[model samples]
Target: MHIQNVRKWCREFAEGHTNVHDEAGCGRPSVLEKPVTKVLFADRYVIVREIAKLIGDVSKTNLDKILTDIFNYNKACVWWVPQMLTDEHKKKLMESGPTHTSPAPRRISLPNSVGKPLNNHTALTWLPVTTSFQNLYCVLQ
Candidate 1:
């Protein structure tokens, strides 16, 4: 790797490089509810509705993280204090959440102290309308 690249990246960050998954994201994600709508998501991940609803495979490990983040964020609770999940929690997630044939790769955003975790694809925009890669990193841990 080029040292210059590191410098460029560092200058783009705030204080230093942080992780998006710093906060505690464990167990099944809480159900998604319409902040305005009264209908409950049946305590299920509506990620199905977000993209294509085709019944396909979702990796277990990846789904676990997604579920954990979804659950905590849904409840307005911290998402990355723990950084991981337990076996029992994983089992619970499988039992409670959607079904997939296999574990595929995944990319997810995170919760933050300031706003929210930016999706892997979502560009980061810091306060004062400034764009920052460092500020964009998840700052829970």
Candidate 2:
């Protein structure tokens, strides 16, 4: 193979699209190291060589194979919690900002009273079951 082919092979291998499958699907490593070594320790796990023999012991060749073995294209979708302002932030906003509230009307309600508006004077009348004559007072005010 030409030197250009070697470079192309290295690049392709780093992307982890090599043909290494059995009757079952091929297993790929979780991560790939920048420079392939005898042993690469990832944050999750240490990836040691599965096969002991080293056909191409050089860093470039080793890196290519290791990268081809690991670094799967399939990515798992995960829900990530983002950083947000805390209760302290809300308290600060409340202290610095103007407070808002609904306005309450100043009026009283009577249990059996119904109110109506009229421009003319009206007479007030009443009926009493227990007494003989019942009177009611009213003003135009």
Candidate 3:
């Protein structure tokens, strides 16, 4: 405890306050894990604000804490996925391929003519970009 808190508690005790524990309705309200987990699992793309709206009586900060600290969830692309993949999740990911795990395939659109508007002759092309899953390896290893 902080020194200030200790001094204050000592003074309270000197004044004959026998209660050592905190009184009721003190500090942050508790958030239930089951409801939060259910909402999260129901929609992988759900944001904190949406969760707050659905859950009610819960702050975004508390939701974030529940997600990261309690559940070990992390934002991967637009999806909320587990920070640490279990053996089953890993197997599914491997079988489904990396593309399945990604929210969308990265692509770069290239116009043949930068300044000119597209006509019958103007060609637009998209180059598929590959992202390395190096971060996953770092975490998993």
Number of the top-ranking candidate, with lDDT as the measure: 3
Report the C-alpha lDDT of model 2 over 10-104, residue by residue, as the tens digit: 88779996853343545764233543333432211122232223323444444435444453311111111001223553354245443466333
What's the ranking of the predictions by lDDT, best on top?
3, 1, 2
Better of 1 and 2 by lDDT: 1
* Model 1 ranges with Cα > 4 A deviation: 7-54, 73-141
lDDT of 1 by residue, 25-135 (tens): 767543432321222232222343331223234444443344344333232223332234345544543454435875532323222223333222333221112323243
* Top candidate by TM-score: 3
Instruction: Give every collision pair in model 3.
Output: none
| Candidate 1 to truth, TM | 0.21
By summed lDDT, the worst window of 10 consecutive residues in model 3 runs over: 108-117
Better of 2 and 3 by TM-score: 3
- The residue-level lDDT of candidate 2 at 82 comes to 8
Which consecutive 10 residues in model 2 have the weakest lDDT in total? 73-82
Model 3, span 32-111: residue lDDT tens = 68888788666655678888999998889988887777676666441212234456655644554436456532221122
Which ranges of candidate 3 are over 4 A from the true structure?
1-31, 78-141
Candidate closer to the true structure by TM-score (higher is better), 1 or 3: 3
